[model samples]
Target: MSAPRFGRIGEGPAAPPGGEAFSELLAGGGARVVRIASRGHADAEGAWYDQAEDEFVLLLAGAARLEFAEGTARALAPGDWAVIPARCRHRVAWTDPGRETLWLAVHLPPH
Candidate 1:
């Protein structure tokens, strides 16, 4: 049997210049857990993400906004969360520039 581990989710380096930092915390059985750190980052104009796996995201610090291809948007604050279904077109619209915005993401097989 595998032993349990302990770690802090919010502990990580700052995002790199002009890009967010993504770290895979765990992966198994076709599911993955990731940590994302962003600061003043946003998707390129007219760009969107259409992923094959469903994503569940939770904001742990700072703030962010997500825009969808369906002409909708959602703002997220600390402790907020959202579920993006597979193939749902979306993009990171905005992130707090003054400080790092931390996120916890779980990618799961499409249902």
Candidate 2:
């Protein structure tokens, strides 16, 4: 099998059940890059992600809404980008179901 291409990977819902699709594109030096695909996916009510790594996410296709623990929510469309600090809780609020929402996320290990 050949290595995966960022723009060529299959997108949409997870093949199994109860999850979005996540593919790790790169990992090294305590940093990781990932691709996430959401097809009408959202975080469970009151669920938040508190991570030790800082994340910078770019919306590559479709649209989404992200809510943060700081009581802020932002709509993201194609070409939109967001920088989330380490341990800053956040959650996926919504995504378009008609099409896949693709995201390129870079996770930098906390210092």
Candidate 3:
């Protein structure tokens, strides 16, 4: 089969807080690759992601903080990588509006 494709990053749509902007790079069977960008605000609310999927996030730019419902928090900087387990209640606590936070998100089933 042919490989999947993706558009240029600058050509992608703008993402808003509490939401995300992404461009699919690959997809097949039960796995997908996407480039995402988020500019979460200080008051951004947390959301419950699907409990059956694991997500790998790479920070490409800017800075932010991630907090989990279990009371764990971490500061994320450029080039930082985080693997959020399935069913984790997490949210962005702070973000630098002066800089855009670019992320590469890989979503896959639990290994």
Candidate 4:
């Protein structure tokens, strides 16, 4: 048998200029785990993500804010987590400019 995989959740490549860095950590059984590193990145005005898969996001470092289509926003700090249903319209409203923000996102296949 092969050894179990090992990795750190808080470590990742640097974020790209004016963009976030994404890394796929694991995938199996129609599920994907991604690590996103962001610094001062936000969605363009009126742009939103309408994903077909359900996403569960966990804030691992720094801070951020998520805005939904319903005209509400939720702020996230380290250790905060949220489950976004599939087809939910949402966008990254803000991210910490002075520090790197790390997010662990799990995407589940559509029903």
Candidate 5:
């Protein structure tokens, strides 16, 4: 058994954030939980990501926008979430540039 420790999910250094960073909180049994931070970040133009696993992502702070190859788009604010199915083509269109955008992501095996 593992002992529990309390910690803040949004606690980060005061330095100016650059690019996107991730921290894996847990990983086992074909599932992974991660915390991600983005500052003035977006996927490369015309680029898409197609992953073998499904991803459920929650926005913890700031805002983000995502566009899919199917021409659908979503805007997320703090406390909002999105699910990306395995093999779905998607890209980040935008993230709040004025502050850090924090995200909690859960990647799971394909159904």
Candidate 6:
């Protein structure tokens, strides 16, 4: 068999509401991996996630704020990383349109 192929996350067309554009980098009998980047505009509203998948996010550029259902919020910037537990309710609260924020999100199976 040939080696696996990986795709660029943001090179394709943009996605719609709740739509995520991702490129699968690795896949096998064990785990599947992909790269995802989301750019949010100023006053842009985000979708709420309530799934059972765990998410790991790395901020690549710009700045934004993330709000959780527990009434907690966090300001994020480049080089920052956050892990959202499974079934956690969260969304992006704010973003700068002039400066688009790039994020790499990795959705992994539950431990």
Global lDDT of each candidate: 0.92, 0.85, 0.73, 0.93, 0.87, 0.66
Higher-ranked by TM-score: 3 or 6: 3
Candidate 6, residues 1-111, lDDT tens digits: the string is: 888655654465443333334555665554456554444532234567675878788877667788887889899888898989989988878654554456777677666
> On residues 1-111, what C-alpha lDDT tens digit does candidate 4 reach at each position?
868998887777987645699999989899999999999999997999999999999999989999999999999999999999999999999998888999999999888
Instruction: Score candidate 5 by lDDT.
Output: 0.87
Error of 6 at 17 (Å): 13
Which candidate, 1 or 6, has the higher TM-score?
1
Per-residue CA lDDT of model 3 for 9-99, tens digit only, reads: 5456666864567778777677778786766555446563444678888888778788887788899998899988877878777776665
- Please, what is the TM-score per model? 0.94, 0.84, 0.76, 0.94, 0.90, 0.68
> What is candidate 4's CA lDDT for residue 65?
97
After superposing candidate 4 on the true structure, give the runs of residues whose Cα lies further than 4 Å from its correct spot.
none
Where does candidate 1 stray beyond 4 Å? Answer: none
TM-score of 3: 0.76
lDDT of 2 by residue, 39-67 (tens): 88889979999999899999998889999
Q: For candidate 3, give the lDDT.
A: 0.73
lDDT of 6 at 57: 84
RMSD to the true structure for each prediction, in A, is 1.1, 3.5, 2.8, 1.1, 1.8, 3.9
Clashing pairs in 4: none
Report how far off residue 20 is in candidate 1 (Å).
Answer: 0.7
